[model samples]
Target: MANTRSSLKRARQNVKRNTRNKIIRSNTKSTVRNIVDLVKTKAQDALDPQKIYSAYLL
Candidate 1:
């Protein structure tokens, strides 16, 4: 249990940050999977240059 006010506040912040991090991590994983699938299914000549550029920007 948190005994001090500061400790309690820190604990709450940690929970918020953890949730935010999880969301970001999940999005990154999903984006990577989508890019991989696109690369596999599309021929090199048929792939969109903008898509590859956007993936690098992410």
Candidate 2:
């Protein structure tokens, strides 16, 4: 559907960025969910400030 070469290139870039963003969003959601679950369960590691800070850093 892209009529010009530049548009086709942009379309390809959009697809690549969408895929990458989806992966990052999924990972962030998963990490947040895990942290919430750990807090609810009162897990010892979750109580550590360093570990919790490091989780988001990763």
Question: Best by TM-score, which number?
Answer: 1
Candidate 1: residue pairs that collide: none
> Top lDDT: which candidate number?
2
TM-score of each: 0.68, 0.66
Off by over 4 Å in 2: 43-58
Give per-residue lDDT, candidate 1, residue 37: 89
Model 1 misplaced regions, further than 4 Å: 44-58
lDDT of 1 by residue, 1-58 (tens): 5569999889999999999999999999999999998888786745779888888899
> Would you list the C-alpha lDDT of every candidate in the order shown?
0.89, 0.91
| lDDT, candidate 2, at 29 | 100
